[model samples]
Target: MNIKIYQRGGFKDNHDVLINATEYFCKMLMSTRMCNTLNIRLEMRSTKLGKNGLGSCYTDALGSKKNKDFIVIVKRDAPITDQLKTLAHECVHIHQKATNLLQYRLWKSDGKFHARWNGEELGVYDAIPYQDRPWEIEAYFLEDIMHKAYFFNNKNRPDLEEKIINGFNNALNYLESERSNNYRNIVSRQSNSLEMAI
Candidate 1:
């Protein structure tokens, strides 16, 4: 996909790492053809998202068939691992929207959001609890798989581990060279380093 990243507040100093991670997440979640046709915007926000809200995905169109553009917002203050997981979760939503597996509509009469899964309307969005939503259930299930595949299982992508290690080291080196206390703190919190696991 044509991926654009915008960072605000705490994430402004780590643009390169976010870009690399976004591209990696998109590639992992989307097919090559789908990637070529879609445009994605990932916005990193340092603003509070309330308790348990890590990220969200928004589409250009209500119907999945017309939704080719997506905007994803992620909480930047979270740890790197949590940020990546949230990205993966939002990426799953993008895939869901792009493939017409999930769709949403806003009713002007009731002024409420409605959702559909494979052509079945599921009532108002707010009526269902967040965790009980089918799309969320699917995204949550896939996010763990994506995270594990990226960090642990890479038989299908033998070069992935090495690439991640190199990228992680390069990020650390950049942070050290810049000598930015903010960047150092960011890296320190990401103690769940790829190098440590790999």
Candidate 2:
């Protein structure tokens, strides 16, 4: 597993700065995810795949018969929230590809861009599992949870808890709208699935 993050020196506004900081934290937190799930530290590596203003991801499918582990790349200067969302989205892709390519779903396909997934849309996470649109909903939720976690973990934040709560509420609004009825269904199914397996 590989997760790399870089900062671009040119940030013109406060929002831009926040976005940059968010990207850095989000990338680091992704390593924690990889560690918990794959039981290894995700390596950080610089890639020549795409320019900072654009986006990118690459993989070799290491350590298993299928797409078990792989390399990923992204430009250093993308928006933090959007980029974090994309990162979570791409991780979902890796999960999908590993699950016998059954989970990979890119709706309204664009050109070959790994991190710039789904489409040029607001909610990219919900664009997975093609036939089952609920995956994107969960992806968006995961991104928010991670974002709030990052914000709360940030020592520099003056009002960290408030910011996290507000961000979560905002995310909930969007997810509630996007997932509609399937939100409860998905959560219920997930709970039951875990219960039976455990």
Candidate 3:
């Protein structure tokens, strides 16, 4: 999948700021050595307006693939360095998809699609398990390594730090429990189906 990162801005300052964020994220990804394993293509662009966002992976032809060509677009208003965290978070999903980690992540919950991710299943575009699994553990670890001590401490973005810790911890726990329950049910269903088929 080709993932494009777009930002909004035409000035030199915008480039400098955005560059700061991009370098940090790429370095993190490179250091993690994830790029060598994941085949997804990534691109970055800047925009002048719109909420900083990441994503792209519409289903493939015939609705089998939820989103094939992925794109992560972000606005220039956000502190580029901080926004990179969001990219890191999403990039983990891309990694999961590239490696088929998703096959084990999907679970049916209340007739709806769900994953261990902080976001909804809709984010993954699949009722398929593991499609949109949570990356909270990875996100938190990366945030601490990349932001909490350096950016957050030096910039005094305590509020951001509080939100990251609270949100990541709470979301990860909920997602884990939900995923476990859903997986159990899915296994039971699969077993029953196999028995019936035989």
TM-score, one value per model: 0.71, 0.36, 0.38
Lowest summed lDDT window (length 10), candidate 1: 175-184
List CA RMSD, all candidates: 13.3, 12.2, 12.6
> Model 2 scores what on Cα lDDT?
0.45
Task: Give the poorly placed runs of model 1, Cα more than 4 Å off.
Answer: 11-13, 152-198
Colliding pairs, model 2: 125-136, 126-136
Clashes of each: 0, 2, 26
Candidate 2: tens digits of C-alpha lDDT, residues 4-39: 334345442444443444344434333445433431
Pick the TM-score winner.
Answer: 1
Model 1 C-alpha lDDT per residue in residues 1-198, reported as the tens digit of each score: 677888755646655655666667667666778778888888887664667789999885465455788888888888878887888788878877988878888888898888887677888877977755657755764575566556553356657766654554464355334332333444444454645876
TM-score of 3: 0.38
**Predictions in order: lDDT:** 0.70, 0.45, 0.43
lDDT winner, 1 or 2: 1
lDDT of 1 at 15: 58
List the candidate 3 regions with Cα displacement exceeding 4 Å.
1-8, 12-34, 37-69, 103-198
Give the alpha carbon lDDT tens digit for every residue of 40-148 in model 3: 3333445322343443332222222323343444433446554555555555445444333342233344443334233233333354333223343344334434444
